[model samples]
Target chain A: MFQQAKLHWTQSLHLELFQNSTKWHTLYEESYMDTSRPATQTATQAPPQAQLDIDKLVDEHYDYLFGYALRYFRSRDQVEDLVQETFLAVIEAVKSFEGNSSPRTWMIGILRNKIIDRLRLKCREAEGESIGFEQDLLSHLFDSVEHWISNVGPRVWGSCPEGALKQKQFFSTLEACLGKLPEKMRQIFLLRELDGYERDEICKTLKLSSSNVGVILHRSRLALQHCLQVNWFEEKKARGPQ
Target chain B: MISCQRATELISKRMEEPLSLKEELSLKLHLFICEFCEKFAQQVHLVRSAIKNGSTEPDDSDTHASAEAKERLKDKLKLRS
Candidate 1:
């Protein structure tokens, strides 16, 4: 009986080891797959390794880089063009990247300059000084908010018990609601909620008064609440039964 | 005593920042006495949370980038040398 008990323990130990080994192997395979893709197929045509590295850098950071562009341009269609422009600039300045920061940060810095240049071009095309005035006002307003909010403790909403899947659902609903907002109000909402701009800064940037900013924000939030209530909560309630 | 409308405005603004001591005391006192207003406040809070936690699927336009455009961009980048 003792011998049989010892054998059973040994068998269980072996099974546990086998399961752990399988998990480790699965993780290894996943990491390998993730890293195996060449950063940029475009760079494969380039003869130089450094040029290839720069191309790879651009490819890796494309999503967030485009997101930043879309934030400024407020148009998804413009994002691709802006990203292309950013890459072109990066390629030209590849040798000068200096490695002073992480490649992502350096690429973002280049993209920032490109965005400013594009904005300036748009300002010129508008055939009015309003754009320049708005930009100046925006910068000042944002600086004030940054000073105020930077020191305040980060806001934590209630803990999400449902995990990442639910959180993602929440984000998607918010995004849709945001997309449905009127153009000016949507821009203001994004600037404040997503970008963390202060109300004063938003008013100055958009060339509106504090009351105007408040009105727009208030309306935008109300609209979003209405949208979510109708689309998410009501649907859930209906499916849940009386 | 503040009217319901004034109380509602103050309640919404208070959510955005720390309310003044007097404002806080007023809201608390009002909330204690008025069940309807209390329920309204709670509903508003629920709606705010729903909005904050909301998610929706990606639109069709976002789901599939034109493969042709991606190929064209790739070719254009390849030609830049």
Candidate 2:
């Protein structure tokens, strides 16, 4: 009888949680609809053609920039701000955009300098209290990442079981996985993989060597694979048996 | 056996683009012979696909900056322009 009662209570709690999640999903969808068009209008004021160019540019590149900034700032609030700043800088500097590289490449080049500038300012404000050398910083960054990846485990991958539902879940998991990566590795991965920059361009833009970029990307991928396999996939398998 | 080290390098390149015919054949031949390497390859492929289809979409909120921030940045750029 106690077991039955306990089961009832637990089921009720899950139902409540499900209802709340549905409510939140509705709220999120509405918020997206309410804000998206206006945001686009005010964000880029280029003419129709230029607007199209900017739209394509943003669609293709924004995630990479957002992810890149998120790694450095380690905060979502600042991610959008940094991305907006990056775009505004790109727009203002568009006249000087020589088309020497892909738009994504050029924007990321701008973003790298912006990030370095921000970091230097941060270091200055901290007043040489020892933010540590670049190598040390990178090591610390990866150490935390390796730790997180070990904890998060593997991810689930398959055909989307419930259409958009699966896609959203996958994306949410992907974002969380990205958050777990070390700052520099995350930056390099997003810049190279997500943004479609050539390795040479990534190395030049980030002032990293080709070898360094390769090492960072390899580690990032391994960590991501491990996180997915352990966290999402194995857990799903366990649940499936029950 | 494809060492994890070599597999790591090839995995990076594969994500960017499929391996060349010769390289692809070599990788497949290795996978046919090595269960662990095959699993590793499948996992790498899964990660690549996930990222490819993933939401690199900009957040909808960033469509517009705060008016005040926009003006400030514009003025600053104008000075340089």
Candidate 3:
């Protein structure tokens, strides 16, 4: 009789948690609906005259799209698949293009949504393994007493360049470092940094605790700063005269 | 004095939300004396700015799509069109 009561309480607890999560999912989806609904609704029967020149579009934008997709997917085939999906989405949604933005910008907007949808699915699938990645990285950087190790501590990076992001070499090196991050860490980092999602919003969207998001973001920044210092700054010094 | 690890964590945390007065004061005190942590704080700001500016779009000079992938996509679109 006692076991039965305990089981009933646990079941009700799960139900409450499930209901709260569903509430989060609905709230997340509602935000997407505002931006994504219109183009998708009209996508089914795009006017024939609205047909985009697929060949031209591919020739012009394929590189940019491919490079962008590589940020999320490592394998060339997987990246190709994402780019293909983006173009297909563009073809379907072209009629709804309001000419308010350039074609490149519009396609980027579509591809961004597609990437987010894929990430949302991935987040659910990898829920268990989310936060513990690169715990060793933190320890390796610091010590048992929560102090940075002597040999592994940060170096002075000098001044940041005036137009650092505009430089292709620096940006590519940054992308490579980002690619080196653990998958879940990279996801949360990008969602916060690149996509500009708020902390609470990220907690809801990825179904992580607020503290977990904070830890992941903190570790990711540490790792990334180290990577940039090594790959970009030190390497530049090595190649140049003092 | 807080350890550098704790100081760095607070430094990153401050980016997400305003730190408590105690946290802010401790972190500020730590950064003031520790050259490495000070450099680290600057790098964090630099990296955050770089990510914000760079990653949203593909750079023109970055890697481009292969011909085969483009051809394959074009062929697939042909069937749909």
Q: How does chain A of every candidate compare to the true chain A by TM-score?
A: 0.50, 0.45, 0.70
Per DockQ, the best of the predicted structures is: 3
Worst 10 residues of 3 chain A by lDDT: A16-25
Task: Check candidate 1 and list the clashing pairs.
Answer: A138-A205, A141-A201, A169-B55, A170-B53, A170-B54, A170-B55, A172-B55, A172-B56, A173-B55, A173-B56
Highest TM-score among the candidates is held by which one?
Answer: 3
Which residue runs does candidate 1 get wrong by more than 4 Å?
A: A1-49, A52-55, A63-76, A89-168, B1-22, B27-65, B71-81
A68-171, model 3: which lDDT tens digit per residue?
66777666787787888888876665544433234555555566666766787887676646445576678778888887787778876546444556667677
Provide all candidates' interface root-mean-square deviations: 11.9, 8.7, 4.9
Residue A119 of model 3, lDDT score: 80
* Alpha-carbon deviation at A84 in model 2, angstroms: 4.9
Query: Residue A79 error for model 1, in Å?
Result: 3.0
Tell me how each candidate scores on DockQ against the true complex: 0.14, 0.17, 0.50
Candidate 2 chain A, which ten residues in sequence have the lowest lDDT sum?
A20-29
TM-score of decoy 3: 0.76
